[model samples]
Target: MTDGEPIPEERGAPHRGAVWGAAAWSAGVLVLLVALPWAARHRLPDPLATHWGGHDPDGSMSPTGAALFPAGTWLVLVLATAALHRFGRRAATGRARGATGAALAAGGVLLTGAQASIVHANLDHARWQDADPVGTAVAAVVAASALAGLLTWLAARPRGATPAGPRPTPGAPVMAVPPGEQVVWLSRVVNPWLQLTAAVLGVCAMGGLLAPASGLIALNWSLVVPFASTSVIVLACSSVRARVTARGLHLGFGPFGWPARRWSPADLESARAEQRGPAQAGGWGYRINGLGTTVMLRRGTCLVVRNRRGAEFAVSLDDAERGAALLNSLIARSDRTAVTHGDDHR
Candidate 1:
């Protein structure tokens, strides 16, 4: 098989154990979500307080509705993840399972927490309107959900996930490597406008929050929080670094590079450089369009790679031509090494 051809077993099919574990976790969480509130039906109001507006309850539902709503929502999320693992390219690549696990974990925790809070708030209350405030509970649950998601994403990452494919088409650019010499290409790109925008939004969000707390001015937390979130999201995609080496392509996002992507030589089908614009990529920041996922920051020339699944990832950077050429060369070199090793074993 050529390098670009995926192994028979790795053809976008999820591991059975992973599927079972995710299913089990989802079922257990769903049961707990429905059971906890039902178990305390006698203690809770006839129509439990389910939604809060600021410091007071503004929405309520029948005991059964309260118990089933969140459970049903959780069920839908579980099914979505199951479908991803069952039918998408993520099954074999295991690339998105971390995110899927994170969503599942976070959703389960959030829904369970919400249900628990509702039950606790409505306990011993004759009417749903008389239920206690759940503002603090909501805040705590959100924090817990975020923490759980992060932990799950980290834990669910596929281990020892080697690339599975034979070499792709031979037309990809090639760079001859000298014997006993190592070749590496590194490039970094940043959009100052995006960075400045993120900084401005972050500062505004902080000021808005602090002003209200300091008695300087009144600001809605909802607005400030969204601003802060937007700032963070924008900052994360404002800059990117790319490196091509023997290990293949390494891409780092944001300044600290906390979130990164890597592809080994054997995992790639092809690499090339092409001119791309934000319009083509559907605006700035990280974009997923018909052209595939593009990290478009003031796009001009982009280094694009097609992986074994035929998925393309493109990043705007300077000197992209050389980077693409180097990656293709590395892939070719890896293919040659594999052939040599096979002959030796024979």
Candidate 2:
């Protein structure tokens, strides 16, 4: 290949064991979700109470409709999550694969559980006029439990080691600006997509506030705070600067940045350049998927840095290989210094 050609990767096949296991869990929840209403069909009266205002149901629907909504939602979640799991697993590998699949499956299960609890609370042996028992605590408990389970599952799951990835070219570093004369490699990356998305959100919030309907205006007005705030941030701080200085590797907005994330040579174990597609990082922005933490701005070649604690930090930008090589070199130099100092002390 040419001198500047990017390294190719050995993107391995999906983990069928994890895929099937997650699918099975999703399917089980779906079946249970469907079965609850189907078995209780006889007990549920016509025009079942499906909507709740306070502790009691205020609105009603046909038993079949009530049953179908949750059932259908479960079915859709399972199918959609399964597809995401399959595609997500492809980009992820090892423990990330297992963790991602588990996260997806657990998320789907929690949704099903939350919905099931609300639905079950409404189920009773009488005609449809507020006969069912309900409470604020019950709803709160269900939500809290489901959230706890999701977090617990995520925490318990390992971040996993990076799989066998494509290797960087032997001598071709992406951005090896000779630090001999000048002592740093500095670059900037602006996220136009984030700006665009934030703009759209702001416009939607404005439109919602201007909406004729009172409820619509309330919803729109509610959005205005977060949307406008986020828009301002995106416009003002969407750009990130990567600097490799004498100290170590630095990434943030600028000298004093917004994110304020820095990695010292002593803190990191290794760094490597790899091709990071959108799927690999499990979406965009500062995402925390199975791969650990990713500061994704643009998708392409990126630097994956593994810290002493084994967590990975990834950033996608121009001349990623040079940055990675420089960081790795810095880490090696620091290690040698520490070893030499330790022997001298002895």
Candidate 3:
């Protein structure tokens, strides 16, 4: 097996158990949200009214109470977010899972804070009716912080280390490690859940534009629109696959997107591992900053490929040394195979 060549497995469709898991969690969130108003209406009874100002004239809910509602919502969101992280970890690589969880948590906090601020401003100007804006904002912040912390914790869990139903057979070809030639497999680094969430948010933002009172909704749409677009772009790059072969190397981006780019062994320059500090690597994927090209998954090693034209291909692989060895083997095989064919023709 050459280094850049695709490792042969059973040639089955890639496992999508993670997607199913994410879907189940999404359904659970929907069910909970649908039931929340009814379940909490009588029992919780507007924390803002109970703790801050009191009930409104029509008993609808004070401003403070409305603000406090986000706390409860965040609690539910936190649980759902945790579940999403777990599902992502199972479906995606560790770095991707962590990045997705962090992005979701950060995005949620920003959105919640912005909404709370707007509500506070309205209350200050006496433009809106009902509760204590400050109290509500505080409650919302607390809830958002808790949820974010929970997501971070969940994302930090070990990868490919989960206890799935059963393990692969011990001597399976896919499981076997080549002698003296270590292999490094690079999976998609972007989280599908994150991409899906961004798309949903974008759609919601568009929907808000149609509403009569949608000033804030329109603002939200602006924020979410860019995020959705960026996520899609990142997902496209992460899905590209590159494999070393006896004759050459194969490169394809995304699962079903883009044609593969192949390069003959003779066109290759050199393959080596590059190391960088936290500031330079920018936490995984193909990062091209002022420090040059780097593919950082973990902290340590990145596979750097330079072609004859001096173009560089950097991929963040789990095992750097192993991947380097594999590439060397592939190059050697290509040379031998080319020589044998030439001799035979003569």
Candidate 4:
């Protein structure tokens, strides 16, 4: 395949297990949420004290309604998350499917646990009046969500490297590497979860405005703030443009000339094409962890560049081999020019 073209992952893929596991885990959690509350229906108060505030039960819903809300809401969440992921996966060259699955499952667990805790706190007491339903609900959502995120992260462990078709060209310094060449590589990715999250938060934020006193404003704000901030942050990180100039290599978020990473040709250490799967980035696009910064716009071949400090920066682009070739060629040309200038000065 050409270097810039995404490697077709229809072959053996590492994230396959993670994706299937996500499907199973999400469905299982939803099932448990649905079944457990119904089984405990009889034990619950007739009109469950579903909402509590200031150490008093201020709001109540029929026990049947209380049980149904979490089940129904989470069911929709799972479906929406899954469907968005199905399309986003194709659009972005099969990236972040695991993360989308995990997020859906984790969100379901949090909502389910919140309902369960709120209901149980009221039911188990001799006087349902003593239970603080809202407090328990909030705490349960936070704690359970944290645990679910950790579990999802662990579950996403890389199974293996994705095979990128035939053996790649060696990373050795090629004598024919073109130097003084001008080249640009551009790529962009969309994470459906971000837009899905934005929609959910925007809705909740509006709901908060409807009844300012219900504490939903506070509750929804809590969710909206961080999620919105993260979405905006990654928004910049996901869309990228890479260029190899006479000066060096450049990476940036936009066509704007400002705010770009320019690597002086002298600092250029090595460039090679790497084949990776979603497992490598632990989901998708602009993943910056212990592995350094990975601008994964698509799967298959990527151009990874290392500087004098040994730090690696990678971007998934079409014709990665060609990009790497161009980078090395530029480095070679720069060195040759530097040497020629040095001899002339002497």
Strongest candidate by TM-score: 1
* lDDT (10s digit) by residue, model 1, range 237-264: 7777676767889887865564899999
Candidate 2: tens digits of C-alpha lDDT, residues 1-43: 2223332322332233234434554554555555555666655
Please tell me which model should have the higher TM-score, number 1 or number 4: 1
Model 4 clash pairs? Answer: 3-319, 3-320, 4-318, 4-319, 5-319
Give per-residue lDDT, candidate 3, residue 274. Answer: 64
Error of 4 at 296 (Å): 14
lDDT by residue (234-314, candidate 4, tens digit) is 434434556564556767652122246778778988788899766886667667766667877567777788888988888
Q: Whole-model Cα lDDT per candidate?
A: 0.73, 0.57, 0.45, 0.57
- Sort by TM-score, best first: 1, 2, 4, 3
Count backbone clashes in candidate 2. 0
Candidate with maximal lDDT = 1
Q: After superposition, how far is residue 209 of candidate 2 from its true place, in Å?
A: 8.9
What is the TM-score of each predicted model, taking all chains together?
0.49, 0.43, 0.41, 0.43
Residue pairs with backbone atoms closer than 3 Å in model 2 (clashes): none
How close to the true structure is residue 207 of candidate 1, measured as C-alpha lDDT?
45
Where in model 1 is the C-alpha error above 4 Å? 1-172, 217-220
